[model samples]
Target: MAQMTIAEALREALREEMIRDERVFCIGEDIGIRGGWGGAFTVTLGLEKVARERVIDTPISENGLFGVALGAAIMGLRPVADVQYGDFLFNAMDQVANHIAKIRYMSGGKIKVPLVMRAPVGATGRGAQHAQNLEATFLTIPGIKIVCPATAYDAKGLLKAAIRDDSPVLMFEHKLLYGSKGARSESGAVDASSDIPDEDYVVSIGKGIVRREGADVTIVGTLLMMHLALQAADRLAQEGISAEVIDPRSLVPFDWELLEESVRKTSRLVVVAEGPKTGGIGSEIAATVSERMMDYLTAPIQRVASPDIPVPFSPVMENFYRPDVDRICGAARKTIGD
Candidate 1:
């Protein structure tokens, strides 16, 4: 076993995937640059030296690059497309939410899009344009699968699974939880490193993991919110609140069974996310739990998320805007009416 940062683990996964599949290539801006930040976070640094042809750099056209990836995917090639920031996904909405996501259904299940889309999300003082957590926007999209891994172990495993899968997959990496180092390291970064297994393994795309087992309340979170939820669980434990922390790595095709199991035991649920409150992933989770596990829930479901406003540039407001340990704990208490 080896302790690896999120960036390192992801780079390792990309390297392995390319080696495992001759047709697996990467398309993104600055990823294969001579000395760039390696797709904005060093996740692809030094990759070009080994996989030069596979790690193809592109212009700053998200729509164009993603269109090319979709074309290659349809041609029986696995393309891992990278977006510098999660917010930029909007620029490629036509290619992503429209064409690529609809081709299989449009073709009556005769085609498969073995494409992996990677985007780094979370607030880091980049203001509204680059710091948005846009995962919620694609949750309702039918074809693409979403995976937001919080730990290095999950990053590697889920990424491998995404590459091998026969359908389109979206992987959202948290900027603050990447554990990136050197010039690409993030301020206020959390320790999300994990001891990755030496042998190959894959975390199933639709499964959720219980990071902390408890019985008082269940906290469901993704990306950096997952880390914060676990921290909140630790703090709430001191107050005699046993919070069960769950990392729903895969969003679409969500593991409702695992979450229902936790809600059944805890009899309380608090969904946390960094996205906006309204019509967001949290809203869907709360509604889903209310519909599926209403009888199991002893209290009204609560959601902790940012307001429906653009992300702030100021450090103070940005910190207040994103869901933190305090915010999650408060939501847990509110759900239980403590």
Candidate 2:
């Protein structure tokens, strides 16, 4: 067994995948350079050593890089593209939404875009531009698959799964959960580092893992917020309230069945997120629960999320903007009529 940070785990997965499959390659900005910051978060550090030609660094053109990746994928090459920040995904929206996502279906299954786009998201006092929970944005797109890994083990497993899948996949890694070192360290970083096994492993996408089980209320969260929800569940335990925490690691092929079962047992639901309250993944999950399990719910579905305003620069304001354990606990309490 070896301990590794989430960033290192992701790099190992990419390295192994590229070695295992020649068609798999990496294309991102500053990733293959000798003395670069490893694509903004050090996830691709040292990858140039083993696969120099496969780890292709690009200019600062996100659209151009994505277009190149889509073209390469259409030609039967697997390209793992990285965006410096999740917010910059807007720069390549056309390539991701219209081209990479729909290319397979539009081609009548004649082609497959085996592309994996990685983005780092979360409000870590970086103001608004660099801080965004992008799950909601990609969930609206039809053909793109979405996976968010919260732990080092999941980071390695899910990245491998995304690379092997035939459809285009978007993997969003939270800044606070990346365990990034050096100058790229994020504020409020959790101990998401884990011990990885020597043998190869892959976590299946579209499955929900229950971090904690309880009978009182179901708390659903993803990425950084999932950690906060677990803390909230622990705090609620002292107050005689049992809370079940569910992490829907994959958003596109969401494990709704697991959530429905949790709601049926708990009879209450609380969804927490780092994104805006309006039209976020939390809102969509809440609406789905209401539509599918209205009779099973004892209280109305509630969501704890950041406000619609831009993420602020002040530390105090940023802390308030992001969902915290106290906020998650409050939402769970309200859901259970506490």
Candidate 3:
């Protein structure tokens, strides 16, 4: 096993996938340029050398890129499409929500759009336009599968799974967790690197993993928030609180069984998400858990999330905008009547 960052692991996954399948290729803006930063944060940094012809660098048009990827997938070619920032996905909402998501269903199961769309999300002082946690936005779209991998191991495994999946997969990668080095490095980034195996492997989509086990409370988080939850768990431990942390790698096909089992054991729940609180991923998890596991819950489920406003550009304001370890700890304590 070799230690790797999320960015390096993702690049490896793309390289291996493209090598494994001739039909697999990558298309995006500034991805394969001679001196590019590898499509925003170094994920595709040196991939062109693997397959120059397959690593296509396109013009700065999100809609056109999605259209091209959609067409390629429809024709039986697997294209891994990506955007520099997840906010750019809004520019191609029609292509994603309408055509790319509905074509197979409209065709009565005969068509399989095996395409993977990767987008870097989360706030990192990029302001409102560039930094937005889009998991909630795409979660409403039925035809697409969503996965947010917070660790290097899960990132590599899930990316491989998404590339091979027959349905369109929307993968949300956190900017601060990319562990990009030097020029592409982020401010106040968290370490999400892991020791990766050389052998080929895939983490099944929709399966969640328990990051930590406890008997007091269950805390669920994804992407950057998952790291914060772990940090918050450490702090709560000092106060004699045992908090279980869960990372739902796949958002669309959520791992309800794993989540329910944790909630049953702890009888307390706190969902932490980086996006806005209103209609956020945390909201969905809390609502669903309440509806199905109300009997096991001892107290009302708590949610730690951002406000319903655009992410601020100012560093101080941005820090306040996203949920922090303090916020997560407070929410966890609240669930346990602290």
In every candidate, how many clashes are there? 0, 0, 0
What candidate 1 gets wrong by more than 4 Å, as runs, is none
Q: Please list the residue runs of candidate 2 whose C-alpha ends up more than 4 Å from where it truly belongs after superposition.
A: none
Ten-residue stretch with the least lDDT total in model 3: 35-44
Would you list the rank order by lDDT, best first? 3, 1, 2
CA lDDT, every model vs. true structure:
0.92, 0.91, 0.94
lDDT (tens digit, per residue) of candidate 3 on 1-338: 99999999999999999899989999999998998788888888888888899999989889889989999999999999999999999998989999999999999999999999999999998899999999998888999999999999999999999999999999999999999999889989999999999899999999999999999999999999899999999999999999999998999899999999999999999999988999999889999999999999999999899999999999999999999999899988898886
lDDT for each residue of candidate 2 in 7-60, tens digit (9 for 90 to 100): 999999999999899999999988878877887889988888877899999889
Model 1, range 1-338, lDDT digits (tens) per residue? 99999999999999888888888998998998886888899899888866789999998999999999999999999999999998889999999989889999999999999999999999998899989898888987899999999999999999999999999999999999888898788888999999999999999999999999998999999988988898899999999899999988999779998999998899999999897999988899999888887788888898899989999999999988998899889989987887
Return the top candidate by lDDT: 3
Per-model TM-score versus the true fold: 0.98, 0.98, 0.99
lDDT score, candidate 3: 0.94
RMSD to native, candidate 2 = 0.9
